[model samples]
Target: MLSKLFSELKRLPRYAILLAALTALGMTAGLYRLYAGLGATTNMSKVFPWGVWISFDLTTVALSGGAFTLAALVYVFHMHDLHAATRPTVLFGLLGYSSVLVILFFDLGRWDRFWHFIVYPNINSALFEVSWCIAIYSIILIYEFSPVIVERFGNNRLLEWIKKLTIPMVIAGITLSSMHQSSLGTLFIVMSPRLHPLWHSMLLPVFFLLSSIPAGISLIIIGSIVSDMLFGHSLSQRVLEKLGWLMPWFLGLYLALKLGELLVTEELGLLFSSGKYSLLFWLELVVGVIVPMILFSIKSVRWNRWGTLTAAMLVAAGIVLNRFDATWFAILPRQGVTYSPHWLELALLVGVASGVLLVFTILSTYFPVFVETMPTRKPQEAAVEAGRAERAPALSGD
Candidate 1:
């Protein structure tokens, strides 16, 4: 098992090397921040306690919802046609959640006191629930992904054991994902009066769950496109076609829900009246939501690779911006402060992102992540092709 894990790590590409270098740099900087204290490297003040780390971590993990979304379609909805997307989605989800944990570790002011959250149970705090869920869910993600490693390593015993554990692991993953995905939004709930009216609502958790579906799906689409381009293979065009159809529906629902919330809250005027916030809001809605929805809604555009990719990218960006707006801008100003990340904080952000990309590149190259079983052609067609080859040989002989 140790050798197999090592080999898997070894299969990581040069980019992963670069990622490791950056992660090391970031880790060193992070250590300095931790030891020297937040005042040395972060722009965080008591009023603006959360900054880039919290925003990025929350957004990334919520977007990682792609794993559960895909699993739901495949295992629950019986959409077996999308099974090809399953492993890759799960892999991305694992990486995303792992990155969140790293950010969480860095974000804690009392780094040494982190163990208190775990060792001393606080079942009361929503944050306590969120943290525990994130930690436990990460483990579930690993176990869920372990079978792929077992299969690749040709470990029949381990594979058998994992297979037995699969159902339980999956159940646990879904439960954890559902809980934390909502709990993340709930984290903002107590901030009530601090959050902008547009975002402040009891339904925030529901919105979070709803938004995550599209975000997750969009990430999968983006991941698929990147994997295809980098690896020199085509994913099932049929699957892409199906996902293309599905994405628009989700995007449409997201838009409708958002608009509905704005209207019901009597915050529709805020879209135009909130000045700078208004511009950010519209950009999130238009560039991220509207454009992607329009592009994806059209079958012609969805079928075109570039168009689909563009839509997916936009949707992913929109999700990120929306989360940022909610956590940083929307909430902070109401509390009479604005937050800006320091250079070191920004560098750490970049480093974590680089590490994620590096890990992905390494894993894709070494794993059977992209390989699929091709359908057999008819015997008659095969014979005809063979006959053509035979005739060419006879012609050369003549």
Candidate 2:
């Protein structure tokens, strides 16, 4: 067994090995944090309750929106050609949400009771809604990803059954995702007093949901490029261009809403006067939204793989920065109360992220995560086949 393990380990590329090493170290740090408690291992305090973990969780959830966004386009909106991108996007979403759950567990002071929300529901709380949506949607993602596994095992009958459930499952997943994506912003609504005016607004939930559309799309574009480079699984340029085309509309809507809110709330003046907050705000918008929006709008850039990839990276980074701004940087700190992540916090984050990437690589390598091997039955076709099967059996009895 030891020899076999060594042989398998030897097959990993240098980057995978590095990722594995970082994951191991991070896990060790995470374990120590659990033993020592948040107070000992984290820099969070009464005034600075949320640290990097919350920011990461929010950012990840937003980016992971690709799973539902793509599902909607392919299944709900009947954009059949984009089906090829859904499997990888969904797998990324599953891993992204799984990472969020793990980080949330560690962030909890009483990590043991992380499951309490399941039994003791909070109907009015945005956090409660986000929690349920993420948990249930993760299960939905697993369900959505199951046909690939069934296909790998050549289980045609079971695969058909799973396919039969696909439409309803995709619908449920989309609905749940929409709820939580917006609700994440709603989580900060109560903090309007502490959150900087430049980043705060009554329309935060709308901004979050709108921005997620572009972020999710961008992640899918980037994921396609990475999959091609790493595993030779590439979505066609036309499909990628179509996906890229979506960014400007959503980004534009987000921009309009953000500016409109500031205008109505009379916070527009703060845009230039808020010093560093203004810079942070513009940094997120220009680099993440405006540049990518323009890049994606251009026909040539959208068609160019490297151009799309660069724009996508900016969009993803921008959304992540926005999350950090809202959750940490934009908050008005209490007198003499400041926060920075401890080394352990940083280690755990890197470890978790590294672990997700490593697992994505292994899973894609083994489980047909790319589009070529995924089941290709459209929902309508599957339904028709099921109907024919049912009718044929009954007719034969006559």
Candidate 3:
């Protein structure tokens, strides 16, 4: 078992090298930011207490909802068709949530005093609830993902133990994710007076949860394409094709909700008003929402890899814009404030993103993240390789 694990690790030298480089760079920037303070390094101000880190955290965690969604389908809905994609989804989810936690440390004004969030435990504070939920959800993700590592390392005892905990962990994950995801939107509830009426609805939490479904699935589709291109194998085409079917339904529901909210609130006209906010609103609706839905509606286009990739990219981009619009852009004008990230904040964002990519690359190379064989490849090719191995026996005999 040890030998097998070591062999897997040894096969991933390039990933290890990349991870090392990213770690060095991230730690250096992180340390510098800590020593200098956010004002000294980042473009953050009293007006914009949150910047790149908050945006990144919101986007990444929303995308990580893929894990809970997948788990729900497999365990609760009995959709075993998605089972193959679960492990990789869980792994990515864990990394995504963990990365958000790390970024939050850098985001706080008093980095050293962050422990007060846990130690003081303000029961009435929404921020406190969000923080604790995120912390617990991260732990749930770790446990959900640990089974794969145990299986790969051939630790039967550990694997058995983890399997026993899977049911409880899945429940915990669903509950925690539901709380924080909504809480993320609720973070803006206090700022309602500062947000544009078009975006300040009480249903922000529902909109956030609804939008997350498509965004999470889109990330999975894009992640699958990247794995196929880089690793020379497809994970599950049937699952992805089914995911294509699922996208439109979620997109339709989300669009309907937004339109309904606008109509009910008499704010639909804001889509055309001339301003930066209007431009962003239209951009989010048109590029992020409308274009993808139109392209994906065509059966031929939905099945095409490039089309799917484009849609996924747009959906992901739309989610980012939506969050920014909700948390920053939508609130800024009302507050009569603006913000742009300084070089240090930008560097920290890049460093954290690089770190996540580095970790994913290493793990995929060393573990069974991608399928062992191409699901879409010809059977004859596999047969030919097997035949060649048999024929080579004569040379060894001689």
Candidate 4:
């Protein structure tokens, strides 16, 4: 009996176990911080009310922005070839928005008063707009995601109801996502005087919206690759190819807009300056943008599976790096200091992420996130089987 139980446990996914452990640790830290108050726990102070949570947690909402981009492509624009990518992206966005709200609650001084935005109604605040948009978008995402559950249960009536509302919900999601994504950039626009010129621009909203394209695509790519690594099912090569084609075009536009803005604003010299800010700025441009663009523009790189994975990782890192520079690094000159997250704060982030991954794992495991069953064979095994076709057939051969 003990042997059978151990066998069952061994069959469980490793990621699920990791998530469970991290989630437990994160929750323990979070609950302690909740009762202990922010003063006793976090490193955040008067000069820096935001730290890693704001940079990492908040930026993740945009990272999850891939849901809307994919929704618009497959649903609104009717790119049916890409439909397989949509459900997973929507699931990702749901978790992302949920995680951001949870992180925001942790960051609050009066966590209980979070609902005050709805009750008091501040029409003038950028945060107010962002709050409303996220709230509405979260609800829409719930509706959008319901079909997954309904379909899993084979509930035709509920599925039909969800289908009727699907188009409207997708449209609403795209609209509200646009609002909050750009509004995130708008939040920093008001801080222009304090923002490093290399990081600040009047076209902040445009950049945010524009960046969302590659951000969303890169994340989907990374997620697709991860799912392949973890489960062996992935989007078809054509769909990924389509996504790869998009990055170079979008990056080209972004590079032009950013470089032109720097040149026109006379901040071009800063690109060559000596400082931590300049160093980070160049890293963001070079590692994140230029390298990915050059690699992706090469047809051989974007079309090859491994090459595509490398390009996607670069794009994801680049977007995250750019957001980080904008949110924390660029503001250092004004604050006259550096900031880092507290251990508890880092724990909360880990916990939040673990929870998100746990939810995704549970849903994907049970639901039809992919229409195809994931292969059980590893990539090397599959390759070997391909080489010895008559002697061995792999799980992915069909």
Candidate 5:
């Protein structure tokens, strides 16, 4: 027994061990932060209450949009072919949101009062709406992912019951996701005075919602590629190409809205004149949006494995930059004060991220999260199996 256990431990990957170590350190840091309070652990203040944690939370939530987008495509739009990618994407989304909730807990100054938002209602507040939506949507994700669990137990009856409610749950999940995704943008609308003009506008909510679609699609594409490489579990290349095909339209729309808003608001000059802000904005737009948009528009690029992966990575990177710019970088720091996340803050963030990856690795390893994309049987074998099945009743009767 001891020898078998040792052999199993020896087979564990070096990276998995590193992730476990980081997660352990992160947990220690998180516990310390809760004991020491935000003042001691974070670099946030009245002027910069939203720091790296908030930026990470927003970015994660945006990327996690894949779960709903894929769900909508499969269940709502009847794109049954895309169902193969839905389970893994949903699991990714669940872990992504789980990390967001953990980071939010650490970011809270009054960590013990985290439940205040639930019991204390504030309909007028955008944050209140976001809180409720994220909370409800997380539950919806669990419900959506429950089938993966029930399947392992061979609980066909329970699975059928869950399947019966699947459509309604998916609809509810989509609705909740849309609400909070837009509401996250609504958060910046109120900060217009403090936020740079390059990023601020009356249509911030619309911009956010539009951008998340491509971001979600990009994440799904990337996740598929990664799973294929790491675990040999993934959707077909043609399916990935189809997903890539959707990117250009959404990216183009986002580009149009962003440029149109700048034109309407007369902030085009700021695109060049705002110094570092201009550079940051263009970094996200050109590399993250425009370049990937042009690449995805090309048939050869979208069809090639590496090409699609590259485009998806760019789009995902762009979303992360856009979220960070809106949440932290673009926000004007008060007079002489500036915010840089403490080392512990970053450590905890790393830990939470690593923890999610670790969990995903374990789940995907044990669960039938990835659909079987490879053929399992040869033609001769299948023919012989069918022949046996055809004669089974006659043989039994004899």
Candidate 6:
């Protein structure tokens, strides 16, 4: 029976096969690791509850900002030029956040008692805020993403219902995302005493929120490029250029605030020092912030597809590295304890990431995720546009 199943699976596309193999491997390893227990399998302890999983959780949540950010851009800010990019961005967020929730299930110590946050309340806790926001926002992502599936199935009635809730979903998603994205940083605010002097600041939440904007924008850019490359479709040139043009301003604001934090906190000397934290600080700023700034600021780089892609990759990588370093290294650089994820632990991360990619691949393949992937609009939107068209001639004539 297993041999037959493998043979049947082999008939599918190579990408699907690879993803299934990886997902199966990762889940298998994860289950075994769970059975053996975290103490026996990994480097987690009382002091380091937030380890590799937390680092990834933070990174994925921050990147998921693209969903709400792009939503706000198109719906709240009236940037219809970005409409083409919205669905794909939402899809990215849904996959990222949903995957993080799964990874986090294993990360938290009391995995079985995950529901404690819902029944037992901790109003004062930053994690409580993050937990609630993630829950609500992920639901919003699902509702927001459902229309694509609805439309694909040709369910006009269901699609109409989904459309009516679109604007509300976008609004609520932005509100919740704004809360939780910053609260992730707030989780570390209490660690000021333990956190390295370079990263320790009361304004950590502000930094977290601000950096998320550019990181989200960069994520959209990279997603666009990848969709184009893999799906044989292209986004509107004007859309990519506009997003590229907008990236530098956000990065500049984040960079300025980060520097201002250093200045006001009087940590300029720490930035110049040759410590490991100092090195990471420079790496985060120079490579992640400054390089992307220059790249996006350049007309040639921002305008070209490959150029923007390279810049976006750097931006994403920088954000991931910064979050990971801050969580593990800068959190306790002086503690004299080196913490690296066990090989199986890393395999699990890779497996989870592969699962996300595979899911995205499958969804984008079957559903109309890209602008070019499915050119039809939801029935309500089509009707609204049609109604507007009918009135446009009369209004102009009048």
Better lDDT candidate (1, 2):
2
lDDT of 4 by residue, 103-180 (tens): 899888899899999989877677899999999999988888888888888999879877998888889889998888
lDDT of 3: 0.77
lDDT of each: 0.77, 0.86, 0.77, 0.81, 0.86, 0.79
Q: At residue 188, what lDDT does model 6 achieve?
A: 83
What TM-score, computed on C-alpha atoms, does each candidate reach?
A: 0.86, 0.91, 0.88, 0.90, 0.91, 0.89
Candidate 5, residues 88-179, lDDT tens digits: the string is 88999999999999999888878789999999998988899999999999999999999999998899999999999999999999999989
Model 6, 1-398: lDDT tens per residue? 99987654443335555666888888887887878888877787666756788888899988878888889988999988888888788888999998898898877667899989998988889999999999999899999889889889999998887899888888889889889988988988888777887877788888888788888988988777655444544566668788889888888888898889889888899987848788998899888988988998999887798899888888888898878876886777346666777777777887898898778866765677774433244556543433333222222121
Segments in model 6 whose C-alpha atoms lie over 4 Å from true places: 1-12, 333-335, 372-398
Residue pairs clashing, model 2: none
Q: Candidate 2 — which residues are off by over 4 angstroms? A: 1-14, 373-398
Residue 239 of model 1 has an lDDT of: 77
Cα-based RMSD of the predictions, in order?
A: 8.6, 10.6, 6.8, 5.3, 9.1, 9.5
Error of 4 at 393 (Å): 24
Model 6 TM-score relative to the real fold: 0.89
Model 5 pairs in collision: none
**Which ten contiguous residues of candidate 1 have the minimum total lDDT?**
389-398
lDDT of 4 at 136: 94
Residue by residue across 1-398, what tens digits does model 1's lDDT show?
99989765654433455568887888778778877788878888878778888999889987899988887887767899988888888889999988888888888877768778789887767788888988898888888777777678889988898778766677777778888888888888888877776777777777787778889988888777655434444456567777777877887787888889889888899888878788888888888888988888888887888888888889889989989988787764535667888989978877877777677666656666655612233546533432232222222221
